[model samples]
Target: MIHNLFIRTICTALLLASAGCRQLDEEGLQTEVTIRLVMPDSRPVTCLEIRDETSGFYNINTYERTAFPTPDTNTATVRLRRGVYTFTVEAEATYDDGTTCLLRCADYNQITQAITWVREQESIVLLLKSVN
Candidate 1:
């Protein structure tokens, strides 16, 4: 009877320990994202801006930038929690006449993606042909 009781106690302890370790792993899991911005064929962009679209109690107004030929492909990596997100991007295009114009992603020009963020590296591409 004592041996049976000891075996049961050990199994119970191992079950609880495994559950705790799983919780810790979940807390440490974060989505690793790579965003790529592609410029229009006719309009060559000089700079690009990217930001998360959200306005609430916890405002996500922070943004990042990339310049021409700096990263070449205009790519940036961000870490985010598991959730649905909408990312806004603005491309600054300079014409041969030296006039620079900003093309923003809004309404029909927006890029919305749902990310589970469970994978090690997630890739997203946004083409900047929203403007003619």
Candidate 2:
């Protein structure tokens, strides 16, 4: 009777462990991602958007143009499933001479680019170009 009880307990534990692992796998892994925006002329980001192409999940942020700090001030941290994403940004940069121009994300001659987030935590930087 003791031997049967021991076997049953071990089997029960194994089954529970397997079930938990399967559940975790089915849920997928979550990743924390930080995205930063940069403009060629060091402009303050007025608006930003990040989207997961596959999942259609997106986040947007808009900042007051008169904010003190300029470039590198636009940043966002979000939790997402490990996957690919795209970034969009709009900013108004004022030159020393009081000239202003709009900036948007551009990479390798493309207006938008795909970035992958696979690690538990990741940081990404995207370059913005003048749209005006």
Candidate 3:
């Protein structure tokens, strides 16, 4: 019967729509994050690392230090699963016999801004400082 065929077609359409929505929801769970670091003029950084509050730590510079672009000239970007993070950099000092130390971004900067990235968000910009 035509009525049975119409009912079946409607059910199929609804099922497909629900599937598509689930796919969209899964895709929306991730966010693209961009960290823009502001370096000091005195020291040049040799390594950079990012620590997710939820996840562990990630080394941004797996290749040669010179191979990776410095934040003084560029930015760092990564795809994260929506969470908070902290950035750290290691640099050699021009003074003090080229001493290398860990620089924490959150410690030096006074930025108390909280970002809640969502589905339509593009990228998050974080400004960090380098200290000895």
Clash totals in order: 0, 0, 0
Would you list the clashing residue pairs of candidate 2?
Answer: none
Which residue runs does candidate 2 get wrong by more than 4 Å?
1-28, 43-72, 92-100, 108-113
Instruction: Flag the better candidate by TM-score, 2 or 3.
Output: 2
lDDT of 2 by residue, 10-33 (tens): 999999999999889755676776
Q: Candidate 3 at 67: error in angstroms? A: 22
lDDT of 1 by residue, 1-132 (tens): 999999999999999999999988766765567766666556555544432332111112223222222234477676655444544455565655666665554322223332234576687766655454
Deviation of model 2 at 77, angstroms? 1.4
Off by over 4 Å in 3: 1-19, 51-74, 80-98, 107-112, 119-132
Q: CA RMSD for every model?
A: 8.7, 9.6, 9.2
Comparing candidate 1 with candidate 3, which one achieves the higher TM-score?
1
What overall lDDT goes with each candidate model?
A: 0.52, 0.55, 0.46
Off by over 4 Å in 1: 1-27, 42-44, 49-73, 95-97, 106-115, 130-132
lDDT score at residue 46, model 1, on the 0-100 scale: 55
**All candidates: TM-score:** 0.48, 0.46, 0.43
Indicate which candidate wins on lDDT: 2
- Writing each residue's lDDT as its tens digit, candidate 3 over 1-132 gives 999999999999999999999988767776665556555445555554433332222323221111112344337655644443333334322324454544445441122433344443455344444454
User: How high is the lDDT of residue 19 in model 2?
Assistant: 100
